[model samples]
Target chain A: MSDEKITPLIMPKWGLSMKEGKLSDWLIEEGTNIAVGDEIMEVETDKIANVVEAADPGLLRRRVATAGETYPVRALLGVLASEDISDADVDAFIEAFEMPVIEDDDDAEAAPLYEFAETSVGRLRYAVRGNEGPVVLLIHGFGGDLDNWLFNIDALATSAKVYALDLPGHGQSTKQLAGADLSGLATAVLAFMDTVGVESAHLVGHSVGGGVAATMAFDAPDRVLSLSLISSAGLGREINSQYIDGFVNSVSRRELKPVLINLFADSKLVSRSLIDDLLKYKRIDGVQGALESLSAALFADGEQKTILTEKISSLDVKTLVVWGAVDEIIPASHAQSLENADVQVIQGAGHMVQMEQASQVNDLIKEHIAG
Target chain B: MARTLSFKDAVNEAIDQEMTRDPTVIMMGEDIVGGTGSPGEADAWGGVLGVTKGLYAKHGDRLMDTPLSESAYIGAAIGAATCGLRPIAELMFLDFLGVCFDQMYNQAAKFRYMFGGKAETPVTIRAMVGGGFRAAAQHSQMLTPIITHVPGLKVVCPSNAYDAKGLLIQSIRDNDPVIFCEHKNLYAHEVDVPEESYAIPFGEANIAREGTDATIVAYGLMVHRATEAAENLAKDGIDCEVIDLRTLSPIDMDTVYESVESTGRLICVDEANPRCSIASDVTASVTQEIFSSLKAAPQLVTAPHTPVPFSPVLEDLYIPSAEQVADAVRKTMAT
Candidate 1:
């Protein structure tokens, strides 16, 4: 069998939610010699479009998936093999290929990846991926769940034991706020770390979650290895309060669609399903109250209640601050406020740059962690 | 990483996650575990099409391979659900509902209502439905309306893998019996589904596409077709809003009513036969509720009132196409 020689170029999985991606175009056609990491195809997911780089070096034998057609993750998009392999063999291989069944022995006995940790703050839902590595915790913004890190978590998990948590008042966690203040939310993070038995972790937080992360770094410097804030709050006083107010007030699709558009540079990214998902989250029994309380606590006067810029430099931990240039919620200028932190303002990205430009952000985070 | 999974795999993931979450959650169906008594691999087949494959390894006895008797096993599953075990009974095909529907509607569906709300039958009847499989009349049928007519039962048909996972999770967690109709044709259709278990609430319609010219309501495989039609319609200057009614019993009529009020045109597309189907049901509701708002009468594009033909050509014609839906929208525009 020439199976050992033929390397399948499959549709890459970007996040936990992405099932299939459209092959927009193939950069390296059949019969082209390709090296590892060479750009081969442009794949478009519902969330973003990314180039599929070759993982194996060989001659591009065949492009099985047609351009503009979508294929499932791991479905053979193309085949690369030695020039010695005939077309007939490649055709046979493609015809006989069945999607391999996933069966990892370690995975079978392991606890559910997404587990709830009981803390004094409340029951916090956290997904822990990669069993053995440095601990990394992802904290999402106000109204956002652990899903905000959907793109980054798996990517970061490659090098670290990543944990993305839904804070007390958000997601599937306890809805009732104990204190509802920045400190209260920070304490939840601390309690969650203690509950999960993590002595220290690299904290990557977005929006209000970044505020909570900063507060945690200040409260217990020993517990935080490093901090990476992405378009985070607490760096500036001037915030797009209308965005916050609109997010909190909009209950219907008509009202919510426009509100969500502010989060992205390209309003076209505000998909109907995205709006619907938010509506569903909002409709959860205690979610409305939780969101309202959190919003009030964080942005009481249309400005970030706590500016941690002064204390950020004082913290002993290494810090990285990333902001979207067109961030409507929090200005990219806020990235300049952090005295001791390395900052990058991603061009053409809005508030949700971590999601909007996940690959770039993921690369940044990976680089930061490695450094 | 976000992995693309077929509708079958999504269904499997939902059941697996639920089983892992709750100890009482169990699954039973003929060939679900596969190779029950015959001399073959223990976990072979995994259902008629392998939707429930590999789950047996994780859950073990909780994932059961039942006898060939649908009436007996489905009844047992329903009875078990009433007695604390949340049984997910695979009905194999919706067409087989004839053999065990009494157990479904009469017993499981009615348990909570009839028992004065004391009983909770948290049973999910997972079955493959719809035509285009060339499975002939008996094996292929969108019998969603038959179950949706029942007051106590919750009917759900997801158009994609993401909804399939979430809705199935909701169905299993729900205290009432849920008939989850998996369009056989859509089994291979892939979409992004979260690894973590999340529930999409019942009755919330997903607006697949937003438009101002017309509103197209559909579910299951037809939702995809409606979306295709909406895309085609867009090129011709018709912005058609396509709504996937993810759940039938607790239908989001509010969304439909709102859409029709704005667009002044409604087109319902269902793969199910035209007579008293979901399309007709939506048409009737919209016509009655928003008759004054509508610029033209509501149009319904559905399969003809006949058995699903075996021939590929006949079956292709029998299943309502995107072109037909677009034509219906055009007709609404003309009126």
Candidate 2:
């Protein structure tokens, strides 16, 4: 027989935390042509559901995994190669495929890499990924934290130092507000910047985080090289008071799911686990008071209170404000409210445009940082 | 005249006072401050109910307003608790708990026990509970039992502003995760609340009224209902003892057992719905421990096994009344 070849299509790991995933559906038949990045199948993790793109371009020789089956990380799902690839070769390749187990051991290596540093403001917990580049401080809006950029941070950090943080009252940082206004948040961000030893870098903020970024840039133009605002809060008067009220007032799953759904253009992005996560946070003590103070400070009567139109206009730092066209938390029209800012209203995303349309936001952030 | 504040204001004062007293104590929640970057004002409603009003001015960013995301913030509060920041996260409404219960049960509640007592989740989750605001079904639920069942978490449902302030302060300082249930209906209900910060320890039942014939145990707003029933019961020449199980999770079983031993009759008045409720839990525990001492079978005055109704009439009939509590007490007394 002529030389035979085989390719291993192992179960892929999409994120740092994913250990196992369920094969949601198979797009290709048992034997079919597949290419790299091809829509081969769908996979569902506990957190999200996404298409599993093909790793190697070739004919899908065998389907070892079936729909609705659960597999550990790196488990061989199938084989892929040219038509000349023999089944015997595929079987041998499968046998050689190393199924790496996600060690259930709780002895976390390297101290979990996440730590909280206490400062004058509150406990600012941050996660720094990648060794080197211009640091990108990811600030989430009103009730958000470092994890809101779960999809974008790692992708953005490939070329730049990515720092995802929990604001004063937002995440593992501290629930206490140093001040309820943008300056309070801005100061905390600066203190966090100082604690982390980043002299100057990019400020990437979403929603209310947009306001914090603007404050940082306005506070010290020398320190902030670039500003990336995604569905920010500072440039407009119209705000979704109902969503804010619903978010603040909601305590049950039924109440929070709807409010959270209002955050994304794709309401389906708000999953059960997502709602469960929010409930877990809200149930913690002091969070209610901190959120109430923030809401009253940032948005009252469901309208934006801190308008920094002129403050951000004259800044020499490269400014990029991205908004989802369907953004509801802070209207997409607010993107136009900035006169001198480079505003891009992404067509499909909502308030969390960075998450919904991450590639564009990441590209915009990268390009703005380069400038 | 009794010096009083709205339930919202009283809660705000409790937080402000506690934060003032203890620098380690901190507050976090969504939109506790009204205006962030808008044109008009700052500290705009002081929360949806305006409970956290003026805290931003007093404590600065220490009174934080988070993004509308509860998981990140609440988990952060629990996280901060382990790191020495006594975080009090406002859940807004108890109904919204579905969004962040994991932080409460799996994380905060389990942290101390899971870590083998090395950690203390000194976190207080303040959430508006019960129905009366026309908040409909989702916004209105007295699901205290759901939290009370979880060990390692201290649950407090104060009936009045006095207990609200004191118990909230206690929740802040307590070295455990506490789910503080705030009855939206009782926020405006006034009572004399001391300005000084003091903590009422958990597992200590407050004897609202002392009597001889029957013992009525209740909590949250139902304490008032029990008091009112005790008043009517007094008129009927049937003196009743009322005990508020101040801390439901650490529940003063000793007080219940003692009362049962003294009176030989028990009636549990709970605002929560019947079915595996605190009432049922208390009834079952009481019967098991104090069955020999009981002269009569225990009675439970609670909401029906159904969702909190929206109609005024249905809601009015939904919650256990003072009359019903007294009647339950009277029945136990007769038996």
Candidate 3:
């Protein structure tokens, strides 16, 4: 209750499972003034390493946690205060700091983070976050889960209500696909919206999901507020047939390693964990059949079906088409087909532009949605 | 997003996912599909504790409910492995391994070696090990040492759900016979497990806690106890690194050796009885390999040489507590 402002810079929770993080190094020194969003430290979690940005603006009074040490989430890493605070007061603040007691059992049961909704298609699994705003639905591509939007969901959630879903044939969702084509898949999306009570939502789609989103817009124009397609499938006819064949057939890490390299401009981004994750998805009971059905219906003989370029140009919805310039799955040249849509060809990115350049893509998405 | 999954669900998911991936994979156990011959539901009881519950719905007849004979089904599972089918036979309780030891050790375990590497037995025998539920002597022994002593068998006892899932996947995929032990007490212990399938390689020990003063090596339920002890030790400024030896046969002694060499102190905690247990085995190896680096005699914290008591109070005393581990660490520091 003092006149001087105090801020406790706690350890950030990057992902859902990140319980603690190793504070590798501090970017700023003590007594230095810092602004919000400034990179203050480098924190490494078990999954990935990233910089921790300051969420509060103040004078860096004291460093509470040492570098080269790991601290649990909500544990005070540093103390930020106004310059009017004395050294004794800063010491007292540091001494009195207590970690936010996380009653995990209660926290977990209080709000269901990941939920399942029984749709007409199947029992579809989805993750709903954010309270109130313009609702945005994130649809993953072929063989991907709600996790494909891991980097984007939290970022977009700051300004709008975000929902990322696993379609009928993928993730933890039921593997039964009633119709193999885009029309059937679009109906599943509509069914999910109806079940979740999302009357209308701005749609963000990647790869095959992009095709579904476009079809969804075409089928029900009034329901979709806008459309953002990332490396979408329906925009072009030319596809890497070898990649599709390799993905479907490759079982071991050795065979899949080369196949995954095709998705990223930087081959190093195809991490062992990434390949392992995909292999796990591939191993699930109905994943193979679903992939086969989707592949046959959408990309037959390495050629694209359900091209919506002409239809999208005539449509009234606000559209933004984003593609990785070096995308090997679907060529970046396909981004040009959207006649009146704002198109972006991100450089040095492959099929996973959203994940490759997350911050930039997030900024673009935020701007597009707000506009 | 990763979901909080129970150890039982994780094991079930691993088997279910593996069976889906490989056509040759099959599951067999007594009451695994409870009402196998009865007129009631097909997947009635799914094993004693329902570890294989709901798997029958997706995999259908692949999840077989065998007769009450362990030796017969266990032998058949071993024989099926020599052919092409990858069979996952649940021993019900590891205490029942006595009935089928010949099939596991002599046949499945030795087939590859005796045949000059011509034979491959890719079989996984999953059994519930360790005691906590007042299951008494017959149901409660941690016989990891017996399985680990055999040359051809791969032994794995996971502490948490995530490891349970990954290690089970690796065991199923491996060409050698694997004795995958799941602790009954940790069945309900939850952890963030990925929905997607993944495999954790064998022989790599997971660092449960990292510290500088001492190294505590443990597996299964003892890992949790070691972690608790490490926390209490930290308060007394005695930082202890707790390592989980996920696999017993191909134990990652290198990680343990590195940590012990750095700290010059070692403490081994095992739920198994003191004599010929994992604790004594690890202590002997580390001491023999790196004798000069030792600042003190390696301490072993394990249950006494007696049957797991049925009484609640005696059972509480049967398992090695965090207090005992912390005291052992203090003794090492004093030495």
DockQ of each: 0.08, 0.02, 0.14
Deviating ranges (above 4 Å) for candidate 1: A1-140, A143-206, A209-371
Residues forming the 10-long window of minimal summed lDDT in candidate 2 chain A: A105-114
Residue A155 displacement (Å), model 3? 4.4
Q: What is the interface RMSD of candidate 1, in Å?
A: 5.8
Clashes per candidate, residues 3 or more apart or on different chains: 5, 90, 2
Give one digit per residue, the lDDT tens place, for model 2 in A1-371: 22245667777654345678889799999768776657888777766665666657888878888887789878888877677666777677777677877656365663354667777776777877776777788888888777787667777778888888888876566777889999999899888888878888788888888899999899888888888888887888999899999998886554677788888887777865576556546645577888999899888766888898888887776788898999877778888977767888788788877767666777788887877
Clashes of 3: 2
Could you tell which candidate, 1 or 3, scores higher by TM-score?
A: 3
What's the TM-score of chain A alone for every prediction? 0.86, 0.87, 0.83
Candidate 3 docking category? Answer: incorrect
Tell the DockQ for candidate 1: 0.08
The regions of model 3 sitting more than 4 angstroms off are A1-24, A33-37, A44-48, A54-99, A107-110, A178-184, A231-283, A288-311, A322-339, A343-360, B1-100, B103-156, B161-180, B184-188, B192-219, B222-335
- Model 2 complex DockQ against the native: 0.02
